[model samples]
Target: MSQTPPSCPASVEDVFACVEEHTRPLSVEAVSLESALGRVLRERVIADEDQPRFDVAAMDGYAVRADEEAEWLEVVGMLRAGDWQPQQLEAGQAMQVATGAALPCAGLRVVPKEETERTGNQVRILRRPADTCIRLRGQNFRAGDQLMAAGVRLNAGHLALLASVGWVRPVVTRQPRILHLVTGNELVPPGQAPGPGQIRDTNTTLVAAFLSEWGLPVQSFRVGEDEAEARTFLAPHLTGNQPPDLLLISGGASVGEHDFTRSLLEYYGFRLLIHRTAARPGRPLIFAVRNGTVAFGLPGNPLAHYVCLNLYVRAALQRILGVEGGLAFAEGFLTEAWNPGRSPWETLCPAVWKLESGKAQITLLSWQNSGDLTPLRHANAVARLPGGEQPLSAGSKVVFLPTHPL
Candidate 1:
């Protein structure tokens, strides 16, 4: 009989530290600016040229020499958007200029379209002393200035900025290639009828969706049956040329006779950093590394596996891809009292926040069960309360990780 591994402190920080110490940045990739969103920056992106590259009009108006009084003159030329050449504006002369058009000349003022009377080749100044609405070159940014620093996850705004800065293709941190293996003898895919003593494999689907949401890439995902079948299926992947940066195993982490993930790791010479943690729902978590890939063994419970991944694995994967804190964390007020039970690891539960008459109040979700996923549907923040803290009271302040706005 195999002896069960000892349980250890389930501090989220300790788990993260272990992950950080073992993982390294993945390779870099050059993708088109249009598709760079959510990927980490492999290198600092400097401004290629000043935004607006030249003095440009900010509105449709008459381009005139601010130093001269122009009552009327021939509109010798028309400047529209994308017109790069600067036109000479002589004294007593005005040119028809459109928004985003290059300034007719330096020291020129603009008479807004609403403030001017326009005829063929001539414009009457309806207002005076209005300086040219010229956007100066490099006003937004200068060449060689850092536009986006390395290790930042790109967003839609970043993509627009990159395109505006004239980068067709930019270097970004390569996607983290991962292999997911789900093991169980009594599990079937969703939508399939389960036989006696069998259930649907919800963990597999949830894990896939979670990884996709994290912006990481998956190379392969296979379902493993018994020990022999699992070992055989994983053999080729372990020795393949393109080995995954991380190997995540779902289920089969317990000491059941059918569970083979732990034994398989030992057979392949992996050093397991953590075999268990004193936490609810996901106590049988395991982490290991072999050769260079980080291997993980998550509990079979769907909710528990997702919680562990969110609290630890996701952050670690981001760090491995050279990303900073995976997401943002904010502070909120506890609306009602909270009572934390004894556990080595802190529990992160959903909390809803609203204005109570005048003050802000945060309350736990309706379903707080470890096996329930309904609570997440209404959860806006993951409240972090100390494991051994005294019973929390209303109006107490707590730090929480906010959910990304939809």
Candidate 2:
């Protein structure tokens, strides 16, 4: 007799809490600024020198003493950017200053060229200078000031700031290595025609691509339906020198006769922290950790695998890296009605979301099932629907998780 699949016993919030409680940031390594993008900072960065080190002109204008009331002044010299030598400004003397050029002396104010008229070295002030147009020394940032705090994910802006602060090499958390195991008897490699009940293995490729995009080192291997063979294949990854930080097992997570992923994991001393989650399209998700190696047994369906990876696997990676992780949710109104079945688990419906006339709107796609991947092509976001007897109507407010960076 076939056994019934076990119901998901963990809520979404509970699963997240469990991940946070168990996961710790990986060890730190010094990486050059050129290769530090998207890496989490392990040490706080301090400014080595004051930004603008000296007072500089904010506009292309003439620098003069604020106390001078002379309507006309003689331009003694010109100061271009990078001219560090100080030039004295007499009571009626002025200097032509370019934007970013250091001010000649203290109490000097810049008069924009547009507000003054010049004939050769002589210039006439057209209007009273209300603004100084001067960037004071250390105005942007002072020396020894905190440039970036620890635990920040370095992006383009962060990298630029680090470079500005003279940090050519910054300490960052090391990326976790991943090993993907594709298991199934009826699965065939891609680019080949499937015979009989066999289907091409797409989950491995999908998981590998996701890991690669995240800049994580990943390796994939195939395992047949036999539990003994699967154990042998996973044995090398479970323990040894340079073992992977995460083991991603595709397929064989459910309570089916052919499903041997959970049993094999147990045999290898993997302790299950999360057996399942109360979320659709990923109900059979499994998370286990042993000896600092984390493993996830994802479902066989393509779309289900994608959803679970985004929800669970990504969370685990963020936790291990000591970086904050969560889907970017935006508020939008439904353009059409959607009513999936009422269950205890929340439903996430794929949808196309766009901004029209400065207003955000989302339309639910025509979904077939978890196995269908066609709908994902048109889906840029996933709309969240609470589990209840009531169906969502058009114009109802909802929150959507974006698939791509918005």
Candidate 3:
């Protein structure tokens, strides 16, 4: 008799609740400014000074006091970005302030370069119509104000903001370390010759690449064959001197006789959080944790693994690390309807094209076998379908999660 799949767990909330109960963040480490990219901030970073640091010029022109008679003032001295003016602007004199130069207190207005004329130390202001080009001190942000709250990832923009606020040295949480294990019996290492029935190992490479994109470094390994050999290979990596913040195992998550990833997880002292989900292609996904490290068991198929890695596994990792705002999902309407051969639940297929009309049109990638990876390259989004007996019509609205989380 066919065994019924484990109960659906009521909803996605229940699955996440179980996942949250088992997983926790890894220990924190300190890194320098250059090494802080992709790491989360552990503490709130306050600005020590204003962003502009002074009332400065927003254009390369003359800085003069704003009054009815101050409009035609003469340029007394020039102030470049790094130079300072020893004398402030007098009643009839203005200082030449370049873009980003600090403005003296006597200057209250700035005329843009295109709107002024200069000869020697003298200048004529043309467009002093209003207070248009003065970047006032503390206008963008003030000193002692919270610039970036904790849990923000340090990206290029964040770095620029921090530098503007005089944060030469800042504190950031260390990137989460991952231990990746690829398990299969018919795999061959890259660059090695593969005979019939053997395929090159792509899982390890893909997993490592994906983790690296998220600012996480992976200590990855590969194992082959059944339960005993797989468990033995993983024993060292999972229990070694540098145990991973997250353990990712690809393949051997299904119910086949050789699929020992789930069973052996219990052997290695992990509590199963969720054995299955309602999503297609990655329905057999599993999550577990031991000693505060999350273990994610992904489907063996490359495309399926690709989907789950971004959707479920990434979510679990971000939750523990206190990282926020990195999750990405897209919305599109279905341009073409599809039906998988023999599944009760709706399958999330890779979208081939998003139409000019803003509709998502896709069919199963040609010859899309579970293990085939050709579809992954052409796919950019995972189109969703609600559970129902009737087939969906074209142009139907649906939600999709992008494979690239950025």
Candidate 4:
């Protein structure tokens, strides 16, 4: 709280620093791996025992002494996978083993059954394997080995790895309670037909969909610009023992007469840290904190909401989960020419970044204004363009932030 500048408008980097300073990792909890998807891990996943603990056959073949020089050998026994009776194989003896069957003894080579002609219990060797064809013990991993480190976001593959080690439950960061309220009397439900001087509400749907990607649950509502109406919706979450960890207020972040986001935050014991930012589409950004709860006043524009959610708000979520990197920026080259108008602040141009010919390529989208929602459906990234009247040509190197999964 004290580290944040109260009056001055902050740059993107300055705001990032302030958020990092104020944010803290949330508490940890143990949950089954089945329910751990999309949750950040808080503990290391260690191997309980050696992988491939026993030497087993990698193919279906005859287990014979590697040094055997005889043209034919006696098939003493047949061993399939899960049958672990081991017997020493003499120079003239062979044991038929299925794939994944343990080797009868050391110094044994597996000759694939396809290379041998078998008649009842007797078999004739048509060819010999060049190698042992055996998977050695502890080949994959050993006991006590660190398979996965902390701060990892769990996915299907991670869960599978945990299951391989018999670790059914993993410790991960608890999901934070998020509350979002979109203010503006001019906003109407997307389902309802709008009257004159009003538009359908898209912020609610956008915010809900954005948060759903992380598997986080959020309670969102469209409240009137009046403080009393907003407080009534906030009463249930505020009066209870468990209050929202993060609160987002969309629209009214500016300095208009109805712009009461600042006043609303102050009235709720939240100390304003940032009033605005030096970034396009998100200049009227507001940030505040009270106790351990964090709040944001997001610009009502559809594109601005998209930018702030994926950029700044995502950084706060990462900090709360102890993620290693705060905000990850990827490098790409422009696939098409871009004529961006000049602006004093950096512009986060909606773009589509995809792999083409093994190269990261970005194509900036066209939007009439900041409130335009046309480009969002096609944008998978946000190109960070430096402020100027610079025209970006095709194949120009640019740095971008991925909005979708890499």
**Candidate 2 has which clashing residue pairs, if any?**
none
Better of 1 and 4 by lDDT: 4
Ranking the candidates on TM-score from highest down gives 4, 2, 1, 3
Local error of candidate 4 at residue 208 (angstroms):
1.6
Best lDDT among the predictions, by candidate number: 4
TM-score, candidate 4, is: 0.94
Could you give the candidate ranking by lDDT, starting with the highest? 4, 2, 1, 3
Candidate 1: count of backbone clashes, pairs at least 3 residues apart or interchain = 1
lDDT of 2 by residue, 1-406 (tens): 1122245467766777777776777888999999998788889888878887889999999999988899999999999998876867998888999999988789989999999999888999888668899999899998888887887788899998888777988999987878899888888999889999999988978887777667777888888889999878777767678777888899999889999888878888777777777777787878877778878899989888877776677778877887755545689999988775667578767789999988789998876788888887887777777776788899999987766421
Model 1 per-residue lDDT tens digits across residues 109-216? 777888888787777877775455778778899888898888877888888888887777878877767888887777887989999998888777777777777666
Model 4 Cα shift for residue 27 (angstroms): 0.3
Task: Please give the lDDT score at residue 161 for candidate 2.
Answer: 84
**Superposing all C-alpha atoms, what RMSD in Å does each candidate have to the true structure?**
3.3, 3.3, 3.8, 2.0
lDDT of 1 at 188: 81
Q: Return the TM-score for each candidate structure.
A: 0.89, 0.91, 0.87, 0.94
Which pairs clash (backbone N, Cα, C closer than 3 Å) in model 4? none
Please identify model 3 stretches exceeding 4 Å from their true place: 1-14, 68-72, 86-88, 119-121, 325-327, 340-342, 352-367
Report the CA-based lDDT of candidate 1 relative to the real structure: 0.74
What's the lDDT of the predicted structure labeled candidate 4? 0.86
Give candidate 2 regions above 4 Å deviation: 1-8, 325-331, 355-360, 404-406
